[model samples]
Target: MPGISARGLSHEGRRQLAVNLTRVLALHRSILDAYIIEFFTDNLWDTLPCSWQEALDGLNPPQLATMLLGMPGEGEVVRYRSVWPLTLLALKSTACALAFTRTPGFQTASEFLENPSQSSRLTAPFRKHVRPKKQHEIRRLGELVKKLSDFTGCTQVVDVGSGQGHLSRFMALGLGLMVKSIEGDQRLVERAQRLDQELLQALEKEEKRNPQVVQTSPRHSPHHVVRWVDPTALCEELLLPLENPCQGRARLLLTGLHACGDLSVALLRHFSCCPEVVALASVGCCYMKLSDPGGYPLSQWVAGLPGYELPYRLREGACHALEEYAERLQKAGPGLRTHCYRAALETVIRRARPELRRPGVQGIPRVHELKIEEYVQRGLQRVGLDPQLPLNLAALRAHQAQENRVVAFFSLALLLAPLVETLILLDRLLYLQEQGFHAELLPIFSPELSPRNLVLVATKMPLGQALSILETEDS
Candidate 1:
C-alpha cells in the first residue's frame, strides 16, 4: 500500500526504484523484448530458463491466471503447485514492488454516492454522447482538474490534445472553469465547438423545464484552438488563448487526458519552462509512439542509468490490461488461441517467403470458430501471401496443441509490463523533481475501465492540504 503520493518518494527512493526496475527489466529483456509472433520460429520458450519452463509448462489457462497473474478464485489463497526457481520468484516479487500501484487513491463517483443503488450523478450531462469508458474518464479527470485549478488558484485551464473536447467541455460547462481546448485536428476542434453549443442548449432547456431550481451555470463555452503541440518549443497559439482581465500574466493550468506520446512531453516542457503555465495533470497513453531521447528518459538520472533503454516492443506491451487479460484467462476462453494461431501463421509465412516475417494480418473475424489451418489461410490472404499454399497438417496440429504455452509466455511478458510503464512515468516525475517542481503519479481512474489509469500531476507549488482533499468526493 505504500506508494507514491502527492508527498512523493524521497530522492533516494526514486533512484532506488529506478535502479531496481532497470536491473529487473534487463534480466528479463529476452521475454519483454520478444515479439509473440516469433513465439514458435524464434524458439522463445527455450529462451526462458529450463526451470521456468518446467514449472510453467502444461498449466491450464485458469491455473496460469491464478498462479502467475495473481487472480485467485474467490476466497482462494494462491499457492504454487510446482516448484519455481528462486530467481523467477524474485522477479515476480520485485516487479510487484517496483511498479506504481494501479489501485486508485480516490473514490469513483459510483463509490461516493450515499445511495449505492443510484447511478452516478457526477457524469449527468457529460455522459450524453460519451461511451461508458469515456464517461468514467471525463468525469474523474474533469473533477481532478477542477480541484487542481482551485488548489493552484488558477482560473484558466488549457487542455492540450483535447480531442473533440470531451474533457474540455466538461471542465468548461460542467465544472465552470474558464477553459481553452487545443487540438491538432481542425475537424475535431470544429466538432467540439458544435458539441459545446449543443450542451449549452441542453442545459438551458433543463433550466426552462424546472423553473424552481436555481442552478449555477457556466458563463461560456470552452474556446477551441486547432494547433499541433511541438514538444521542442512553445506555441503562441496555446499561450495566446488565456486572457486574464484582472492582473499580471494569466495564471494557467495545462491538462491532457490520455495525451499521446510526445504530446504529453510537450505539456510537461511547457509546464516547466512557461511561467504562466503553473500546473499539469496529464494521463499519457501510446508509449510506443514516444520518441527516443526526446519523449522518454526526460530526467538526466534515468538517461544516464545503464540498461534503462526501453524499446518499442516493451513499451507497446506495457499498454495491455493485465487485469482484463487475467479475467479472459480465467474463462479459459477459446479466443486466447489467437496468439498461438498467429504465431503458427508466422512460421508458415517464413517458410513460404523467408523475407516476410510477422507481416500484419488484418483481423479475421470469429477466430475461435476457425481451425488453425483455416486461421492460417485467412491470415496469409490478408498479408498478401498465397492462401492456397500447401500446409503441413502435422506441424499445424503440433502448434495448436501448445496454445496454453503461447498464452502463458505472453502472460509472462504481461507480468513485467507495469514495470516498464512505471519506469517511463517515474522518469517524468523525476524530471519534474530535478527542475525543483512538486509532482505525483496517481492512479486516478479504474484500471479495469481504463488500463492507462495513472495521471502524472505536477505543480509549481506543493499542494499541502489540497492534495488530500483532491481524491475525496466534493461535498
Candidate 2:
C-alpha cells in the first residue's frame, strides 16, 4: 500500500507562509512606529499587539545564523536569507483585509461588485452613442435605464452634463423617449450640436445615395437625431421655462455621467428639490471639488471617516511611479508583478531624466508632486513602452530620496487625493440613503478607462429593505 500523505498544504509550508506573513506585519508595524515617533513621539505602538514581541522571541540566533549561511553570494544575499520582515508585511495585509471585511461597507463593496442590480436602474439604455469602452457596462446601463422606466413609468429623460449628447440621442431616438441633453461647457455643447447636425446630414446624404434604402425601417436605419441644450441654464434660469411647457404629465430623469465634484452634489440636491423629477441616474467624479462641513472640500470619503481627517494645507505631490503603476495595472488587467516592475522602472527613469518633468504625461497633474519611479513609469507608458530593467527593494531604498524628491514638492496635495475622494463618495451615499434611496457602489469601468470607476447607483427600494440587507452584509 502507498504511504499515507497529508492533504493540502504541508505543515512546513503552512508554517512558512504564516511566518512570512508575521514577519511582514512586524516590519509594517515598525514603519508605522517610526512614523508615529517622528510625529507623536509617545505611545507609538500602544494599540499594537504584544504577540509580535513573543513571536520574535521564539526565533533563536542559531536558527538565524543557519538561515543566513544558506544565502547566495549576491550583493544582498544576507538580507534575502532573512524572511522575518516579509512575513510580517504579509501578515499585516492579511489582517487589514480581515478587518476591512468586518466593516459594513466592506460587504456592500463585495456585493456591489458582484451584483449591479443592487442600486442600478433597469431602464437606462446600455448602448448609448457614448461608445463605452466596456460592453458589459453599456449593457448594464441600458438595463438600468429600462428598470428606471418601469419603476417611474417615465417617457422623458433630462441628461445633465451631457457630453456630445450621445446617451441622450440614443435614448430619444432608439428608445423613443423625449430627451433634453444639457451640458455646462459651451464648447462641448457646440460639439454635440455639430455632431447631431452631421448625423442628420449624413442620413439625408445616405437617402440620396441609395433611394432604394427607403424600404428599410426607420428604427433599423443608421440615421441618428439628437437635441442639445445648455446645462448651466437648465438647472437655474431655464428650469421654469422647461417645466412650464411639460406641465405635470412628464416624469423627469435627472441623470449625470461623471459630473465633477460639486456638480454631482448639486444635481442630487436638485433632484431632491425638484418634485417633477421621478428618477435619477447620476455618476459623480472629481471629489476634491466637494465642500465639507468646514467649507474645505476633500476628494475621498474615507478621509472623513471617524478616525481619518484631512491634513491641513497639505500640498499634493506626484508619484509618477505610483501613477504609472496604477495606470498600467489598470490598462493591463490585474497583474501585480507587472505593476511592480513598471513602478520600479519609472523610478529609474525619473532619476535619469529630470528634463521630462511636466504635467499631464501620466495622471500626475502639475498641481501635485510625483515620485521619480512614478514619473518614469508614467513617461514610459505614455510612449507605449515598459521599463527594461528589474528593480528590487534594495534598489528602491538606494534611490529613495531621488525617487521621493520628484514627488515631495506636492506631498500635501498628494495625500488629499484619496482622502477627499473617499469623503465625497461617503457623503453622496449618505445623502442618497437619507432620501430613502438604496444606493450601491459599482465599478463602472476598468481602472484603465478612468481611476474614478466607483459609481453610486441609487434607486427606491421597498421600505429601505435593501439598505437593511446591505447593513446585514456589512455586519
Best by lDDT: 1
lDDT of 2 at 214: 46
Residue 104 accuracy (lDDT) in model 2:
20
My TM-score estimates for the predictions, one after another, are 0.95, 0.48
lDDT of 1 by residue, 1-475 (tens): 2233424578778988888889899989999999998999998989988999998999998888888877776777777887889987887777677788887865564643564433264534566777767777887888899999988888699999999998899888888899999999999999998898888888778778887754665367899988988888988878764665486778889999999989999999998988888889999999999998689889999998999999999999999899899889888889999999999999999999999877888989999999899999999999998899999989999999989899989999999999999999989988999999988887878786788999888899987777777666555
Clash totals, every prediction: 0, 68
Which one is best on TM-score?
A: 1
TM-score, prediction 2: 0.48
Per-residue lDDT over 1-475 for candidate 2, one digit per residue giving the tens place of the 0 to 100 score: 0111111223343233333333333333333222211111122323334543333333322222222112122242334233445544444334333110111222222323544443232223323243333333333344455456556666556666677666555455445555667676778777767666655555566668779754244432112123333223235421332333444555666666667656676666666666656667776655434455432222133223343333322101111122233233233232322222334444454455544332234443431245545545565666455654444556754444232222221121222233233334444555555566555554443332334545555555442333333222111
Q: lDDT value for candidate 2? A: 0.41
Model 1 misplacement above 4 A = 1-8, 106-119
lDDT of 2 at 271: 62
